[model samples]
Target: MLPFENIILIDKKSSIAVYKQIANSIINTVRNGVLKPGTKLPGSREMASILNVHRKTVIASYDELEAQGWITVFPRKYVMVAEKLPLLHPKKWDETELAYSYDNDLKINFRIIDKSWCVERDTVEIIIDDGHPDVRLSPIDELLKTYRSFTSRQPAIKSANKGTAQGTVRLREEMVKFLSITRGLTINTDNILITHGAQMSIYLAAQLLLNTQSTIIVGKPNYTVANETFIQTGTQLIEVSVDEYGINTDQIEQLCKKKKITAVYVIPHHHYPTTVTLSVERRMKLLELSNRYSFVIIEDDYDYDYHYASSPYLPLASANHQGNVIYIGSFSKLLDPSLRIGFMAAPKNFIVQCTALRKMIDVGGDGYMQNALAELIKTGELKRHLNKTKKIYHNRRDFLNDLLQSQLSEYISFTVPNGGMAVWITLRKDYSVKQLQNTPLLKIIRTDEESNSFRLGFASMNEQEIEITIDLLHNLLKKQ
Candidate 1:
């Protein structure tokens, strides 16, 4: 049976603005596998009495959620969970929208793509990218020929009528092999449940572990997409301060003592936007903390593939002796973003719960993509492609670094990752970054707290385009 989860009461000592804290607590309960997805929550009056807060406060918190699409409210006293929604890969930019936008100069393309919604604009625009990995590096021609040549196209996926919940077996087998080599993780077809992308993987993890009112902590100014994923799943995100080693572990123990934190989300391996790697010492400490606090650690291993540095550190999941790490990753950053194709590495004990949550939300991932990716992995096409593209992205990273130093050195600075697709460029001065947002050259979509740093997707662009864009951006920075 699930543990006791109760009405959230905000204390005077809570640092989160009371409304945000309350709403997030509710979300945490729903997402962290606590409050079952469709369970009805207590009425505002009832909740207020339980929490010792004014009815108006509860109503106000519920109102914030209603506006943001978290819950549905009936005229009087009825509140129910909205349906569980699945996040597909980050493929929101539609060509129809792109064709009509009429911004000819500001053309962006998916060198990589998936569910990142915090673009500076609400409407997802096809971000013109310079750093997409060379798809030519992949045997696209051979794969297409093989795809067409398949004489008997046996219905790509078979377990359809049964609610394609466990993902295609062929795909799971391939994914298992990939994890064993890449992350030093091992699990057979039964352990790995495929999802559209890492976004869904993380969401599914939250769905499995948390309930409304459970505390879920993440890095401060975390990747907006993951933040949104947790928030949408009804998990309240507690932002923790991070440093070179990783999240402030001391605060984690403090927060857990103060509140029943159900999960802790971290990008210990080359974190998003900041590009900081968690020291191995810290990875073990975090595992220890999780064991003590009874919380789960979400390890987002997004860029483990394109390691520019020698002997890149192993994943937090690798070091998770307590078996509490929920490891998530995507193929998008390594090779192709459009392919989506990500999975989770959790303890055997937790897989059933996660799969049950996934089954409720998305019966199974797309059959065609899963089958094709399975074939790609089985035939060694994906691995060969990754090896070939790594050199190119490494070169692109070098080129972009050179261009930044040569042209924009005095004005701006960026973190050079040992290996990753994009550079997390934080301006030495904050105002310059803010001013750049006003340019037509700059396209902002759904941008929130990530106003201080801009991600330059270096792996998507060719060197020439990279050089020219950097030149153009250098002049813009000078003007700013």
Candidate 2:
């Protein structure tokens, strides 16, 4: 009565013998708990008629099954599964519901690394992110158009599988020229490795350069994700104090004298949590110390495009360090955070190793998307988009600063950042940032309870939205 015909598919043209194929299919069914122990199988003649195969083939398959201990064939009787075989109870075939329902609170047998620090908060109606770009302002349509064109072209279709682990040739070539003109980087395709995002590039650099015995220096209250990445490497993380002028190079030099420092992680352009640019003096000193102590500098210049006051400082990678700096940058800040496109510029030899390791984790990135982005860069559409967003973001930054100064001066205080999307706000001693975060309606993603501060992002919000957010904050403060 069981659907033996549907379950046992036959391929007459296969190199495998037809009888052996039928035998193997039945064995698999038993292993999968479908054909339970003691279950009755169709007679050889009946199965042959149902399967549209000759009775001799079905007889041979049943004999093979008996020899393999999968079934028992009684003389002048029906065929059935072996009586002594292990029982594998399967769900009833006529049941409508699933056999096993999934439970979110399932128990695990293995231990996992504690990643409590990286918490993904539930999104509310209004979210205040930590310096993210507005996706509405990105030139996504233009990029997608190019992507479609590439997919249709014969040349691109042919090269789809030929992309290198480093990146697509077109994107790398375009990046070489783009970085040279925009960031003043003197490099070729060989010096760059495209990654999923800035965090990925940071991870790749950290994994290759640091080990358990390694000592790396970072700014106190540095980028949380970067700190966590270094900590995961089991490296000794020495935190240097970050002042208005940026991370103290004097302390780094002292540490270098005390021990062999492996690398120094810096966010020179508008450092995270507290947006302070590294001064030209400290930049030079850090380079000098790297040359003196032979420690690598991991420069993360995430938001280098939105300088409102004046021209932003050139990245440390653009300097003359004799290949001591690993520069990381991201287009996510320029476009949208969801668009994960980041690149690393390093010495050719170092890049080769990073590319090899990156392949172990990610074989290759979205080749079509990379090629599309390359077209945008080549046609100056990316630059035009940046110019348009820069003006808008610059205005948003000032607007938020003015609103904070004029309305919320009594509750919070912060220095106006020259560049970057978020303003680092320090709360008064009487109030805690926790109070704002505990509210139901507003969601502030980045907060430091220790510093009694939070990063208020404004670039993603327009003037009206900013006013609405401020009003909500005003009500919360007034309630207190």
Candidate 3:
């Protein structure tokens, strides 16, 4: 009946038993409306004869169907499709139609918040990124070797899946020593909370500290993402001027005198876009202001590793700020951006709250990678890698500065930064920075048309590649 032999196909090689396959086939046939509710199935012996299978296999299939409530069986009576089956309308198959596919044009019923704040990603082969590290120089092999070591061991496997929201114990322990030696930060494991990246750390701090009634202070042309994150919290973001000496701390002091400042977000070392380090005097002033005003200080020291000039300034968090500073740093700059490992150091109580908040969004981080980094630090591989890359980046920065000065000095002017991997170039009044943006061969990562300036990152490119980029700019300027 209904070509039972043709419909109930089976493979002896399949992992699923033939009986279960037959039962599933019969259930599908019923669901597909080929067999109506209350329709009688052929007897087990008859089905075995029709399907050319053993009688016991057919009996077992019938028993399974009966147990699953797909069919009703009676002693010395026929097996039938369940009479009280839920109604399921059969979908007509169409050869020309493709539905339930990965389509972006979704007809959503609910309202979504405006995503105008989100930056759009352009698919480009070669882009002048905003001071990214050269991934070619990353210690991938050593990291992978450590990763393999972890995967091969049972204890490591258990530790990885242990799922601690604060991050792996080995990494936190190593980070305490690492920060102490590198940044002069006197922090312990409890004060640290590992995050996906510095952006996550920044966002978490904003969410915890700022609200509608809160007011946060940032530099005028601060890190765009941090500015956006602060704004999204419905906090009043007061922007002060950032001159050659970094954010005007005096202006910040004036603002603090006028109203209560909730938090101050500062990039003291190599300020974003401008590449100006905050004066040591201003650094002391800001700390004093934070203490006086009773405001939190979110110190974002991303890319603190690649400072080319003399010894880099120690972070505000490094100095005694009386538990008022939340220091955020990232390994994304240290290694590769996609690796996405960062950490936040604050007071133990603040870190506990951050870890709790982190769990609500993400249960845990990549324990394997964290442990691998810990091992690297322990073996001095991370430090060696950093030392080697720092030299290369410093050379590249100087080379690019020379090229810009020698080749395009007529069109643009820039301050050769002491420590960072980028040059803060101010374009001439005659030419718009927009011209550089439109060049097909080159993509300027950032441009301020109002200020007639753009930041050119050099660390990601070699001397030869930097030469090519400069030549391209020279040719474009000549055309303009």
Candidate 4:
């Protein structure tokens, strides 16, 4: 007889009746190919003894299985699986029926967006990511310890069930305090909404703020993913030119005069793709215009914590006297990208609407992980880790700068970023990105066509890898 003891597990406290659970378990075993058709099962008394249930309960389970066509019962004798067992198929057509050809009949109506922005470089051993942090430097052991501590407490696990869509109360409170100390933002828990990451935060902002025919201004060479998010909402994007100082607020002002702008998306601190900080004068002007034109400012400060040189500029949201800035920040760059913890700070009313929308998409973030992060903040572990990694990254930035100046100065020109992780290098006019790709080993680094620049992420590379990369680029450019 088949071992009913191992196959079936009846939870005594579950709302589902024990007999039904047993029946369901057996059916699942059959479906999973664990118990083959025509396999013999133990008698009711034997199964009852094995499962420690009443013989009547076992009989009821078997009877239910028989009623469901899962098994056949012979009078006063044997029970066996039905000869014709139910099988799942993609379609329910008769065996003799002709198969349907969907390719010929169906026509796709949706627009196909080009995803050429994402470069596929798995085959290349050496990678130059677009400004990603070194995962090796993350304090994963401490984080895992905190996670274990959170799970050990029964109360903490139970409290996770009551977490709000906005986020865990503990993490929100911790974030409020953290921001106040670091960024000089005096905000309460009411102004914040935690998201899976900055991308979700951007999507939420776009969904709530933009409607069809709505026009929002952005930098010409902006974060491609955020640009895609805004476009998907049917919003028209007005591109403004970006320089060393950042996106031109004068152009935004000109656009505002022409039409009623809905919102303006900016990366004020170390702007994405081009690591240029928005000038102080432009920041004040943008804030002033936001008040006058009454357009929301979406500021994504993704790598605010990884600033290397001097103190980084304060986010626009921190100085917003007129509550129009929806500030977004993520800890993914500080830690690992796999740890998706990001937050949005805006006016309390905007946060409420965003929270409601967030619920419709995701009920809440990972509560246990949030709580663990809260503990890390409280214990000062997170701050300590940031301090430790900042030094290492700063040294790496210097190393990269020195190597580039010595080896590849003839081929490319770049600015040494004061704060962010990546150095934006503008290729010489003669050496196109296509020409660089002709080199066997130098093709892996992603290049932007808009500015003819390469954003070489150096934080993740070690001394040896950085040396190899720079030497390879130098040799390749010399041949050209």
- Which candidate leads the pack in TM-score? 2
C-alpha TM-score for every candidate: 0.69, 0.80, 0.78, 0.78
Error of 3 at 241 (Å): 0.6
The Cα error of candidate 4 at residue 4, in Å, is 20
Output the number of the lDDT-best candidate.
2
lDDT of each prediction vs. the true structure? 0.70, 0.90, 0.88, 0.86
What tens-digit string does per-residue lDDT give for candidate 1 at 1-480? 222124465667967777677788877666544566566777888777667778898899889877766678886868766566233236556633232234345566644344545344533323434234556565666555655544245553243223346677777778888888887875677677677778888877876666667768988757777776677656677888877677788888888888888888898877776667887777777888888877888889877887877878878777636777788887766556676678777776677777887877777776655666678888888788888888878888898898888888777666677777777666665446557656766553322234466767777778887877787777777776
- Clashing residue pair totals per candidate (backbone < 3 A): 44, 0, 2, 0
lDDT of 2: 0.90
How do the residues 1-480 of candidate 2 rate in per-residue lDDT, one tens digit apiece?
A: 778888898998999999999999998877766888899998988999999999999999999988878999987889998877644556688955432335234577764566876666685667888999888989999988988998999999766546558988889999999999989999999999999999999999999999999999999878988998988899999999999999999999999999999999999999987999999999999999999989999999899888989998999999988898999999999988988999999999999999999999999888888888999999999999999998999999989988998889999989999989999999899887888888888888788898899999899999999999888888888777
**Clash-forming residue pairs, model 2:** none
Tens-digit lDDT track of model 4 for 109-155: 86777677665655554566778888998878888888888788999
Candidate 2: regions farther than 4 A off = 1-111
Better of 1 and 3 by lDDT: 3
Q: Which clashing pairs does model 4 show?
A: none
